[model samples]
Every structure is written in structure tokens, then in C-alpha cells.
Target: MRLTALLASLALAGCATQAAAPPQPAPKPAPVRAGLDPSFELDAFPSTYRPASSEPVAIVNATILTAAGPRIDAGVLLIRDGKVAAVGRDVAVPAGVHVIDARGRWVTPGIIDPHSHIGVGSSPGEANGDGSNESGPNAAGIWVEHAVWPQDPMFERALAAGVTTTMILPGSANLFNGRTVTLKTVPALSPQAMKVPGAPYGLKIACGENPTGGGPGKPGTRAGGMLGYRTTFAAAAAYADQVREYRRKKDAGQPAQPPRRDLALETVAAALEGRAKVHIHCYRADEMLQMIDLSHEFGFKIAAFHHALEAFKIAPVLAREGIPVVTWAGDWSGYKMEAYDSVMENAAFVQAAGGMAAMHSDNVMLMQHLNHEAARAMTAGNEAGLRVTPEDAIRWLTLNPARILGIDGQTGSLEPGKAADVVLWSADPFSVYSQPDLVFVDGALMHDRARPPERPRSDFELGAQRRPEASR
Candidate 1:
């Protein structure tokens, strides 16, 4: 039988079974109005991250770009107790602080990538190692962090490239894949240790070809995909209403039946309640507009649209809706029908339209050179007669992504009160020849190119090396 026909028959069988079942009474629990039920625990895997120990260190005589404003030449940045104590040209360096004269070097806030799949889709791709997606279309109950391999060697590579923070997201195979976890680019034994404490979780949703491409038992067309989203969200709305009614009855001292918990609906309800941020993976302009309308219908805000290749086509609309575009820096297109209309100036166009724009590394290889990506975008924008500056381009990799991940208040720019996540470059960071000489996360020295790690940070790399055979 054809796949579509088989799916249709299964649906009919499910409907007939539901109709033939007799109506059952709802379970009534003992009336008590103290608090919510114990089964509704949202944060079952809370972050246990703690900043690494660091001492007072002062970096002097470097050109600094704060990502918040103009550049500072010959400036001094002081780090104390894992925080930026002072940063400017006239800042005084105390006697006890360890000072390094970074002559001819550049300093900026550590880079942050809002979209990445490094740990979940770890390197040397083995069949058993890949855990970026589940079997079904809607796996909203699953958390990507649970599948994250803390030993992924890419984490240390990204750290060497000045990536201080990143969000490990599920792949875009399903319509509603799972939750996203934000992590600091620090070496650790577990995802919880790498996670950025107090960072809000993001729900990953996809539009266009990715979610509907699967043949059987899935949305096989664009309209079908839309229907699936609407139906699922409608169920989520009903679930929310049922929970609210139960709580209302309980508050009024009336006998109430507790609503049965559904993990998928619980995740959707959290998005509806403005607790989890909604991030969609969309490419086409029309689909983005449709998603905006859907967001309006559901009364939820979109945090960002990742891999938005055609975002330049509707820059003003996105600006009006206050949705940021997290896109690639170069013109990467034609690989798929939806990504065919990409432009190198997509990020610049969004920024020109008075909207927020940021660059992301959807590939593990690309994650190692996000600064170069920003440089490419800036060069493309400048060639197109846009007044894009190094300072502005720097924000695309630093402050802008931090804003997208909802962690800008803590670690985006070189502010006095923010976390001392800073990087010192060998030369102009935008230059291709430049490299990070020193990288710091929350004031701790995490990576130093001058003194590389002698031992592999990943356990997979430990015994994989060929041992020297004993000579006869």
C-alpha cells in the first residue's frame, strides 16, 4: 500500500477506536488548595554551573571594542573576582593584579553563537553518537542537554576561537524537536556543568521543507505542516484551559479533579505562558510571515528565526514585529529550494531595516571562525553601499547573539558589572591572519594559544592515538 494511504488508514483506525470507547469518569482527588501538583516540575534538570576560579588580571595597551559603543585605543581592561572591574583608557591598574601588556593586540567581548549543535551532534559522527533528533515529528518533551556529550572536542576548539557561550539546539528534522540549552564554552564532565546558570530555555520549532520532508506518518506537505502546528497548539490551548479550570476550582474550595499531565502539552503551555523562548528555523519570507501570524494567534513572542536565508526579503516586516534574524554570514544557497534566495548581505539588510541581526554557526567547522564570518558579512555590506563598521560587525558575533539567547544582561559587552568574558587577539580580529592569543570566561583564563593544552580535553581522543610499537 502507498504510504499516504497507510497513514490515512491508521488515522481512521485511531478515530474509530476513540469513538467506540465508552465515556469514563474523571479522577477526583482529595480537595487541597496548598500549591500545584508535584508532577508539574518544569526544571527537573537544573543547572549546577559555577564560574571557574579567577584572580585579578589587567590587560593593558590594547585596542578594545566593547560591542556596546565605539572602539577604545590603548585601553586597559581590569578583571576582578570574575567580573569586569573597569575598562577604558584612563583606568588605573592596581599593584596586586597580574598585568599583561597586549601591545598591538585587539580586545573585545567573547563571542556567543545563538545557534549550534556541537555536543548533541558530536564530531566523528558515529551512528550511536548522534542524538540531535528523536523518531517522531513532535518531541517537545525531550531536552537536548540530555543528549549532549560533554566530551565533544569541538567545545575546546570553539573556545580557542573565542566562543565563550553557545546554545546547543536540536536538529531541524521535526516540526517541534525539543528544548535548547545554553552553555559556556568551558571544559566539563557533564552538560549541567557547562550550562549557563539561570539562562532561559528555548523551544525549537521548524518551518518549510525540513519538518515536512519525511514521507510516512508525518506532514508530507507545507499545508499539512501548518495543519499539524495548528492542531497541536489547539490541543495545548485546551490543556492550558483544563489546568486553569482545575486550579480555579481548587482555589474556590470546591471539589476538583486534577488534570492529567501531558509532557508535550506542558512544554507548549510553557511557551504560551512566556516562560520558554520560541525559536523557529525558517528560511522563506512568506513562511516567516505566516509564522508571525501564528505567533499572534497563540499570543507568544518569537525569540529568533535561525538560518533565515531569505530574511532580507522581509527585513522591514521582521523589524516591525521585533524578531531578530540569526543567519549565516556568507551567501550559502542553492543546496535546497528554500535556501535558494540567500544573499551575502542578509545580516546587513536586517540591520539596515532597524531590526536586530546576528550570525550563527550551524556547522561545527564554521563555529571555529565566527569572527571571520562577521568580517565576510561586513565586507559584503560595505561593498553594497551600507555603512557597516567593525564595531557593528563585532556586535553580530558578541552582543547581538547574547541578546538573542536572553543573556545579554550578564555577559555580552565589556561593561563594568558584566561577567569578564573577554578575548585578546593577536592582531585585528577582523583580519584573516588574526587569532585569539588569550580567552577568558567569567575572568578565568580558559584558553591561551601561546600555551596550548598538552592533553586532549575529550576522552575519545585519549587512547585513539596510535601507540609507538616496541622495536624488536
Candidate 2:
């Protein structure tokens, strides 16, 4: 009885306190905006990634695999003015040049990943943190660079693994996902500093199982997928026509009003204008062919078909059409029906048919072991009776991907007048046991095995608990 009375008293006191509280004011309504201006211009800016090094250096007594040509048994690679000054067995290193005696070491062009999600879909994979757009299937308004977290620790890890450059793409959750940004695997305060200067942006499009997302509204089948591409491209073309007419009339001094700018259609229009390259995620041969037809219908060429497992089945056609296939070696079987036809010799089959094949790592962990990934392809190719040399396999990781990114003329192979993006390996790069002893970007040593290289760590990694082995 006493406990019940005390409880009733407390309840009454709480009610009295609530009744004594003052009334709070309501929140003010936010002011509404008029609308966006149609005359506003979006800047198409060039990259400001200048070389930070001026010191001339020579890596001597190393076996160099110049991806552009034959391997040199004992080569001397000279780096001057942020470029590969020379690469030959008889190239003379001038006096006072910083010499790195790399006897018995192997040297090759820095690895380049044509497809990556390092900064956008970062490690520990949170959905909101990731850059995938699944709202309505079409999402060409997004740019991967805008979502890029420059402090992503994966950038440093990739650099450590000899990946000097990579193309960071938006995820394939949508039919027209977004634009891809090519980046130098160097730590920076912003994505702008990491971007590959003057590299053409790529539009990320997808077909097959990924974009379907199941159920209503989304592409429920392959037919729906093709329809999605056709309809979107058609709309983009119409929008482009409006914009073109507006500009023409304005330039001709005729009274005209500009069309309302659509960011998504603008990106697609950029691809049609050849200002952006098309990088599609496709699997089956039939779907790939349908996409090719759609590209022809839209007048935009597909620069590459990424994750094209069944590209081997249509290798000759792809080669004939001058399209490259970027795929993972030995990463297949039993995932989905689309990936069921995958074979370990897919890369070899494409190469045998005179098609360009590049090994790509869609996974972060696999990206760190790209050389091993190439070795797997090389082994599978050799077993399949294809005469693919180590140099050829290296090109899959370097020059071919560079060409896909449209940055081949700048830095792909250890060629004279190209950026000194090079890697020194502890052994043959095609060997599973090999590791990058040193990595250089634009003639500057970016990663060295001797000491802890100066690289940024994400805030999440800083001051965090690490295992004993991770400290070393």
C-alpha cells in the first residue's frame, strides 16, 4: 500500500512538472528557390596534376620489360624532367644522376587498372557511403570523382602493389550509372589532384544481372535492359538537339530561349559528342552484341566492355570492331547464370583471336595482387596452347588499359618522352612470388620498401587498433 501511494505521488509530481513547462516555438519554414538557370555553364576543366620531381635518376642493371617492345636483359632506364628519358641496354646514365643499382631486380611499367572503385565504393562497404544509384535505373548525373574520398587508404595500398594509375568508376547498379574518373594512385587532399590530367572521362553503363535489381520498374529481363539503353539514349539525343538548336539560334542573333538543362541527359550527350568514352558492364555475348547495336543506333562507340566473360565467344567480332575486353582471369563459376559461361582461358581466347584483352580486378583485395592475377591468365593461356609472352601479359595490366582510358600517349610503357610511371620488382612481375620493391610516379619515388612511404591514411585508420603484424 505504501509503495503504491508513493508511485501515485511521483506520477502526480511528473504530471505537475510537465504542466508547468513553457510552450516551445514552432520551427520556421525554409524559403523556396525559384529554379536553376538554363544559361549556366558547367566547366570542362583540365587536370592540374603536375610532376613534383625534377631530379634526374637512373635505375641500372635491371631486367626491364618495356611493354611497348622486347625485354632487355640488362637495361638502364633514365628518368629526366618527369619523363622516361631512355630505356635500353646501352642507354648511358649521365654523371651526377642519382643511380639506383638494381642488379638482379626486375623493372616494368607501373600497373594500371582500367576498372576500379577504390574511392567511390570504399572499403568496409557501406551502402550510403558508396556511390551506387538505384533510384530509377538511370543515373548519368553522378560523377565518381565527386564521390571520391581522396584519403581512402586503398589508394596507398594500390600504390604499394605497383598500381601507379587506375580508373575509378561508379558502380553498376543503374543502367547508365555515371561518369568514371581516371586517377593517379597518389595521396592528395582532393580528387582533383589525383585525377589523370587530360584523361577523357568514361560513361559507366551496365547490362545483364546487375542493373535488373528484380521486380517492377527496373529492368526485369534482358529485353528490358536493351530497351532501357535505347530509350535513354534517344531522350538524350533529343535533348542534345534542343541544346544545339538553342546555341545555334543564339549565335545567329535570333531570339531564342535555352532548354532546361538535364544533368543526366547532358552526360549521355557528352558521350554522343565523343567527349566521354563509353565503358559498359556486360557478360553474355548476345547481350554484348545488343549493346553494340544500341551504341550504333545512338552513334556513340563503346570503348570497352568490362567484365565480359562471354567475350571469348565473340572475340573476333570485338577485335574486328576495335573494341577491347576487360575481364578477370580465373574469377568465375556458379555465381550467376550470366557468369556461368566464364572460362579461365577467356583472356587467352580473346588474345588468340587478335582481340585486345585486359585483366581487371573488380575486388579491392584482388587489385593488390594484379600481377598474380596476370600470372593466372598467363598460366591458363599457356596451358591452352596460346603463345602469350610475359611482356604481352604485362601489357594487359599496363598499356592496354591505358589505351582504354585514352591516356596511352601519356604514360603506359617505359617509352621515351612518357611519364616515368615505373615499378621495380623484386623478381619477375609475372612470378607469383614477386613484389614491388619501389614504385615511381612522374619520376618521383612514391613507394619504397625500405621505409614507411609518406602517404595519407583515412581518418578511420588513423589511431586505430592494429594487429602486431600490421604494424610492420
Candidate 3:
């Protein structure tokens, strides 16, 4: 009752003040009410501005690819406080927030590239490029993330291509190349803040042919490749044993002994302890099997097989053992002896055999068409009678890769409680001419082709790209 009385008193006071104000000259536009909302000032800009506070962003009238099974036509995807709050046809539009009209568009979880080389080296020309080890057999313990430059121009191109997430990795020239960094490719002002926080790292390892064949020495035979992997892992196992003994002694209250510093050996030690994920670059099925055994011997797990062109042959084995294969619909039979038998039905066959398969674009140019890649896989599957649904193909592009990258729970698919990383297509995504109209990351509208706009502008790309490139 006291609260009601106080409210009535305040209302009466307000009315009295308004009535007591002297009317003089009908002051210009009531001073525009500029101070009514301190956060937003009235301006001539038409593009929506994101305030530095928590607010829900809503996308209405779009088809959402949950990447599970059902596609919600004219669906609503709501992001509240930077995460997906609700996603469905029946979701009620919240009041007092921004609404993005997504009519006549397709919405899917952001494209995830399990194997990528976007930011590790921006300029892949002769002088500045150092990501791929064209040198020795194995260059372990070197983290490729440390060398990643946030200012890379490829980041913008990737994002414009509807890539919202990626696993930045080193090249496949070495047997145990280096540590790979998984991050959300959100464009920001700084690289330190651009990195995805607390994401798990992946270790790049090669087996079968590349390590043995591409090195400076004579690794021309498949037998040589097997030997190189085994020998490297064996040395790594010994290094791990040394580190373990030192830790044991220190724990027993004895004098601590520091082991000799070898950056190459530290990676193997980390792999043996299962702290880093092993992403072995291989193409043949037999080599993949050998690599799996090698992983078992090291007391670790093989996370995913990149470019596993022959993984369809071992789909049953991979499914039974729960290993993932990161490959694509188109990148088959282009280069090596191992790739001679590459098939168009690889991803579909893997999915058909109940094995996890993801589509990855290792090429900077190919990544621009990942959605088309997913569509191609679907079309190929339909033609081959392998019969994977469209949603299944979306899964390959989104959720399955997220699982391989250890980021499924955080950012793949249009789920109720995930990051609002989404791609808005200009047309039916299955059609060849479709382009991503807008891309959103963490509930913020990061890209819009229509806007003039608030996109990133890099120093070098000031007059180069259609979009101003910024760091993510």
C-alpha cells in the first residue's frame, strides 16, 4: 500500500511540473529527447549498431539447419546474452531488442573447417611463408598458433565465405609437424582477443607417404614412411619416460632434475600423455590403420584423419573404434600415389557406414564454397545410392566437424543453448548461385552484404577487397 501511495504521489508531482512549465516560443522539436536513452543517440545511420551491453538478437522467417534432422522453415533463432536461447518455428519474438529480417533465406550453423591453413601464414609466397616444413622429417613441439598472424587477409575471405569457425593448423610436410589451434574466426581489432579462449589444441602428424616421400632424404617407399612414424614415436615414448621419472623423483621430495630441452621431443611427450589431439595427414586406408596402431602403441588416441581418401574402405573399423575422418566431396585423386583411388562417394560412404565424416577445405580458394561442397556431397550420395539426407550433409559441414574440433557443445548447429554462429544464405543453399547474405558470431551480426557497412578495414586491403578486412 505504501509503494502504491508513493507511485501515485510521483505521478501527481510529474503532472504538476509539466503544467507549471511556462509555454514560450514552442521550443524546437522538444530538444529531440537526446538524453532519454543514453546508450543510443538518434543518427542518420540505417545500419544496426551493436551496443556493448547484453541484448537479444532475433532472426525471423528463415530455414534453420539444426544439423540434426529437421529443417525449420520460417524459423526463429534467438540469441540472448550472446548464446542461442531458443530456435524453432514456435519461438515467441522478444520485445525491446534488435530483429534481423531473414525472410527468404537459409540459416545454418556456421561452417567449420576441421583442417585449415587460413591464418598460420597469410601470404603463402616464397619469402614470408614458413608454415609447411619442407625441411626435415619431423619437426615436433612447435605450435603453429604462435606463428599465426591475426592480420591475415584470408580471415576476412574465410568469414565472407560463411566460415565462422576453424582449426588453424600447420602444413603436412613433417611427420609430427606441430600443434594446431582451434578458434572462432570472429573479426576483431586485436589478435590476442581474436583467439578462441580455452579451446583444445590439435597436433599435426603425417603418416604413410607425405612424411617419407616429401622430405629432403630418400623416403620414396611406403616402407620408409612406416619406419619414420614408428621411429619418431619410439623416441617420443623414451622422452616421455624421462619426463615421468623426473616428475616422480620430484614428487618423492628428491632434488628436481630438469631434462634437456628439445622442442621436437616435447611434442611427442605431450602426445604420449594424451594432452594434445593427433591429426595425422594420410590418404590411404592401410596407412590409416597403421597410424591407428601407432597411436595405440604411444598410449594416445588418433583424433581425426585428414584427407583420408580411402577412409570409406575402413568405415566399419573407424565406426567401431570411434575415430573421425576429415575429408571433402571434391578433393580426391588430385596429387599422390595414395590418392589414386579417391572416390566421389567418400564422405557419403563414411556416413553410410555409421562413421563420422566431415568436409574440410584445405585450399584457401576452395573454402569459399564450403556450402556448395556440402551440396555436392549430397548430390553425389544421392547419385551413388548411398542415401545421406540433406541434414546429414549439413551435419558434415557443421556438427561433425565441431565434434572433431572439440567444439560441438559450444558452437555448432542452431541449438537452444549454443553460440549464435550462423550463416544466412541469399537463396536456397542447394542451388549453385547462393551466397551468404550475412554471418553472425556470438550473437553479433558480423557480416551483411547489403550494408555499406560496419565491416572490417585492414591497412593493406584499404582499396583491394569488396569488404574491409579486420582481424578476428
Candidate 4:
């Protein structure tokens, strides 16, 4: 009996000691990123998200770009319920509204990135390999929304740079890589919380040599990538037809046979039905032309051609077809076989042809400097005598991409009845010294150099890396 009691007491002590020792702190939580990541909980839409506030927000005496007309001098914009309530030279300042003096500031819609890899833990290579391509020829069903980290530090940096909205996609290793997620840069612990309310869904497609792994032979060849895309879409169309028939039967009060579900096919069907957008990754002019045909065949619109290094060569045709090119300011590369024809005049040439061109950054580090990207494109345009004005360049980062993402009506410019996604520039945005003095997303002041947030690290960021003091 004594031995039994001692043994029981020993067990209790051991268990208590183990339990009280902190349990290894459960391993430090990774910084949450936005985009295709699933664990970050960004998927919590909860049926609806209404950005309403009791108080009104007002910005007075700022130069505003409507993104469709001449700059409004001495403009006043009022925001209520997280959207632009009014804007004009004649809007009266409401009594109970919060107002800011923007006497010498420049205000435009928050910058839009048609392509970015922010919010996902893209580093520590092995763990995040799933988020990128470098895989097989096709991973169409891999949805990147499963991988976004809402707390990604890039979100704040981009806010500081005037980026409020972005499309996060998986890498272009596969012909049909994954479904893209549009995100609003806000403090959403889950991916659901970060979604751009009412934003259209988009699927990521690639063409040219990108899917061929920049190598030789088979799917490692450009032709193979095209074949793979066409074949996959054909399969998706068949799959969608099967389901549509089932749905029709159910609606007709008949015995409806259930069809197998495929996430990949569902995304493709959404595009075919005009419920989704298609942003294809193509760097060459020829591939861009081919993709336009694919869109024609699939009965969908190609929203934009990402990283179209040779977009200028086909700008006229792209414009004629009403396709937008979200590309880098310059070729920025000449290494790949298809990329050999890239030129410094890509942006200028495209703009001259009346094609919609937007400067996009797929790099996490550059997402914040979209203005600089536009400026780079502007410089190239002017050097080529293309007459691309700074105001016009602003549209590349603002209105053009917004239209591509299908959010032009609500948050792309300084229009009344749009979301109050505004940016205040310290100088003319085209100047090298210009910086975002203030940034507002959805009517909330998110970045103020004079006052910053408590925690600025992204959800994907790990360890004790401190926010830059200058940034803070």
C-alpha cells in the first residue's frame, strides 16, 4: 500500500512537471500571408463583409485623379461606410465628418497589383515548394488561397507604397498552375478575412516557354505548354458540361445524376460562364496571340497577359482584342529562348498602340514600389517619344489593373461612390523623391509616416525581425 501510494505520487509529480514546463511554446507561429495559402484563415468571408463606420472621412484640397479625366484641382473627397461618398470641388464639409488637410497632396485610387506572391511563406524553400511551380507539367487543381499568410509584412509595406489590392497566384511552373485569390491588405488572421469583397475569381494560366521549365523537349518545350493548356481546358469543358446537364435535370424535376466534383474544372467553368477572370502568364508576343485564340475557343475573356516581355510587338492586336498587358517596365531579362526579343520600349510601344498596359510586380520585395515601376515605364515611354504623361502613368498602377481585376467601378479611382482607397503623395508621383505620405484603404487610415501600427510583421514572417524604424 505504501509503495502504491508513492508510485501514484511520483506519477502525479512527473505529469505536473511536464505539463508546467510550457510545452515547447507550440513552435513560433509563422507570419500570415495573403494569396493562395490556406492555413492563414483568410477564407472566412462569413457570408458578407461591410466596411461601415459611424463617422465620415474627409480629405480636402488634394489633387485627385479620376482615372478617366483631367485631374481635379482643389478636390475634396468624402468617405462614408468605407466607400467614397462624394468628390468634387464643390462638396460641402459635413459637420460631424473627420477631415484631413491635403492642401498639396496627390490622391488617387490605391495602387492595384495584378500579380504578386505576397502573404505566403515563400521562403525556407522546402516548406513552401508547394506554393510555387517547379513541379510537374500541370497542377491546375492546386488552389493558392490555401497558402496565403494574412500577416505578411509585405501587406504593410505595400500599404505604405499605396498598394491596397492585389492578386496572389501560384508560380507559373505548370501550364494551369492554380486559381488566384484577390486580397485586400488588412489585418485578417485568416485568408477569408482578407478577400476583396465582391471581387471576381480568377484562374492562373501560362503559355510560351514558362511552363516548359525554360528547358528543352516535351512539356519542357513551348509547344508542349500550349498543348497542355488546350487539353486541360477541353477536359474542364467536358467536366463542366456533365455537371451542367445534371443541374438542368435537377431543375427540371427529373432524376439528376450526380457528377464528380473537380476544383480545377469548377474554376475553368466559372471563367466560361463569365464568373471568373483569366490572367495568363505569357512573356512572348506569339504566345500572347495563341492565348487569345484559346480564350476565343473557351468562350472567355483573357483579363491580362502577365510578364509579357514582348508585349509591345503585339500591342496593336492585343488592344484590338481588348486584352490588357500587365507587365514589367523593361524586359529585365534576355536569358530565356522566348525572352530574347524583349525590349526597353515594351511599355512605350504598348501604350502607343492604345493597348492597356499595367506595371505589375510579382516579387514580394517590389510589391510596395508599384509607383516606381510606373515611373520606370513612364521614363521608357518618354525616352521613346511615346508621350506617356505622369498622370497617364498613374493609371497603369491604378485604373488599368483595377479594370483587369474587374474592380474598376468600386475602388480604382477618385470617383464618388467608390471605396475610399486613397494615397497621398509627398511629391509628384513620377518624381524620384515622391513617397506616399498617407495611405487609406477602405476609408481607414492604414499608413501614416507620422503614426504607424503596433505590429507590422506579415503572417508569413517568422522570428523576431523588427519592423524598420524608418518604416515604423
On lDDT, the leading prediction is 1
Q: Candidate 2 lDDT, tens digit per residue, 1-472? A: 9999999999999999999999764443332222343334444445667666668999999999988999898899999988999999999889999999989999999999999888877765642366677767789988878888877778888999999999988988889999899989886878888888889888999998889857545788777878888889999889888988876765565666667878899889889989899999999999888888887888898999999999989999998888999998856666988888888888888989988989888877888999888888888989989888998999999999999999999998999999999999999988878889999999998888888744335565664546579878
Q: Highest TM-score, which number?
A: 1
Off by over 4 Å in 3: 1-55, 124-127, 188-191, 214-220, 452-456, 463-472
Model 3, global lDDT: 0.76
Evaluate model 3: give its TM-score: 0.82
Name every residue pair that clashes in candidate 3: 186-472, 188-471, 456-468
Residue-by-residue lDDT tens digits, candidate 3, 207-245? 766666654753667687678778877887887777677
Q: How well does candidate 2 score on lDDT at residue 353? A: 91
The Cα local distance difference test for each model comes to 0.89, 0.86, 0.76, 0.76
- Of candidate 1, the 10-residue stretch with the lowest lDDT total is 32-41
* Candidate 4 similarity to native, TM-score: 0.83
Question: Candidate 1 overall Cα lDDT vs. reference?
Answer: 0.89
Runs in model 1 deviating more than 4 A are 1-42, 126-134, 250-254, 466-472
Give the C-alpha miss distance for residue 432 in model 1, angstroms.
0.6
List RMSD in Å for every model shown.
14.7, 18.0, 18.9, 15.6
- Segments of candidate 4 deviating more than 4 angstroms: 1-54, 121-130, 133-135, 214-218, 457-472
Q: State TM-scores per candidate.
A: 0.90, 0.88, 0.82, 0.83
Per-residue lDDT value at 87 in model 1: 96
lDDT of 1 by residue, 1-472 (tens): 6999999999999999999999775555675433345235457788888999999999999999999989999999999999999999999999999999999999999999999988877877632355446466777877889888888888899999999999988887788888899999898888999889889999999999988986655688889889888888888888889988877876666677777777777777778878789999999999999999999998999999999999999999999999999999748899999999898999999999999999999878899999999999999999998779999999999999999889999998999999999999999999999999999999999999989888887887766755568332
